[model samples]
Every structure is written in structure tokens, then in C-alpha cells.
Target: MKTPNAACPCWSGLAYEKCCQPLHKGGEAPTPEVLMRSRYSAYKLGLVDYIMKTTHPDGPRFQADTAAWKHDIEAFSKHTHFAGLQILSASEDKVMFRATLFANSQDVSYTEISVFRQHNGHWKYFSGAHLDP
Candidate 1:
């Protein structure tokens, strides 16, 4: 877990408390790109509950195994290190970004285009497609 004063995992150049922490704590993200960044931060911090809560109910990625999901999230967060994030694009309810992650002392980067939906004035992750780039 990241301390409140640590640099944000999203590489936003802001303290966690001033950046993604509020989103993790229930504050609404104003844009899909912001939500994507907050979700990446959530993964780095092992905030599975926040991840689940921010996921849209109708999203294809929704899973019923809360315990197993939390366990998996914790394991990944403990074993992997978040390196950085790069926002490629943001349009309407979609965002494209690349995340740099390290595991077993090796770098692993991936990009994805994520879709978001606004529900009751809050943006939630709806789904995503991994990009080949």
C-alpha cells in the first residue's frame, strides 16, 4: 500500500493523497483518462475493493469471486512493481494508455484502450481491449 504522501503510481507528478487517493476514497473522477489512471494506481496499491467498486456493474470483466480476486490482486501487487504510465489518448468515454510494470526484475509493458461509462454522475470502468502496440 502506498503512503498518503508518496508520489502517485500513475506518474502524475503529484502526491498520492492529492492525486489518485481521493478517487480511491470515493471521489468521482472527472474524465475517463483520470479514472484509468486511478485504476492503475489502485492495482499498484492492491486496492482491490476500490477497483471492484469503480468497475461498471455491466462490464464484461466483472467477476463473482471476490475473495479469489482480492487474493490474486494482492499477490500481483506484492510481486510486481509499477514503473510508470503514459496516456496515449482520451476521447469521450474511452482512454488509451500504456503501463510499465516490473516482475521478477524484468520490465513488462502493455497498452490498452479502456471504455468507461457514467453512472449516476460517476465514471466507472466498463471494459477494455488490449492493444498490440
Candidate 2:
């Protein structure tokens, strides 16, 4: 199910208007942590443009089919719900995070040490290593 644009329940702790929606609307997210939360919301909302824009170009598995990839992500998110995110630490270009997501009729969690880089004065997600949930 698609989340309402007026308010997101993804638990970023900010109302939709103040949070991910803007990022989805082509606004720059200030931090990797913010970008990460918005990315989760993008999956929930199926905002392909936002995902493609924020994703690091150097990241592996770059696909040319953005719309198809969006559909794939949405299909998965529809079967689940975004729960919450915790930012463990952050530096100039990296962030450690733990995100709680409920999926497949069950709740699953994951930790990621995400690396980001500043390009053209904007932060873009480059890569990440999944940690034990």
C-alpha cells in the first residue's frame, strides 16, 4: 500500500511534509542520515526519481531501468512497513545506522555502515556494508 503524502508513518519522527517528501520532491537532503530515511520513504512511496538521484553513481549493480527497479522495490515494500531508524554514528562522509523494517508478514532488522560522498555540494549515498541485525 502506498503511504499518504500528507503524513508518513515510516518513523523518521518527522511529519511527511518536513521529512522525506521534500527529498522525493527534488530537494537536497542535508545529511546521509536524512538521505537514508528519505530513501526508506522512497521505497515505501515508489519514488523512482528520488532513488536514482540519491544513489551513488559508482555503486555496484547500477541498472538502466529505474521504473522497473522502483516497481520491484514498491512490490517488496507493499508487503511490509518501515518501522524506524537509529543513527549510531556519523562523520564527514560516513554514517552507521540500524534500521528496523517489517516485511514479509514479519519484522526484520538490519544495520548498515553507509558511506556517502559530497558531490556538487550535495551528499550522495555511495556504498554500504550490512552489519548484524
TM-score of each prediction: 0.90, 0.80
Decoy 1 TM-score against native: 0.90
Worst 10 residues of 1 by lDDT: 61-70
lDDT on C-alpha atoms for all candidate structures? 0.89, 0.75
lDDT, candidate 1, 1-133, per-residue tens: 6689999988999999999999988898999999999989888888888888888888987678878877877798889889999999999999989889899999877898999998777999999998886
Task: Specify the highest-lDDT model's number.
Answer: 1
In angstroms, the error of model 1 at 85 is 0.2
Off by over 4 Å in 1: none
* After superposition, candidate 2 runs with Cα above 4 Å error: 1-10
lDDT of 1 at 14: 98
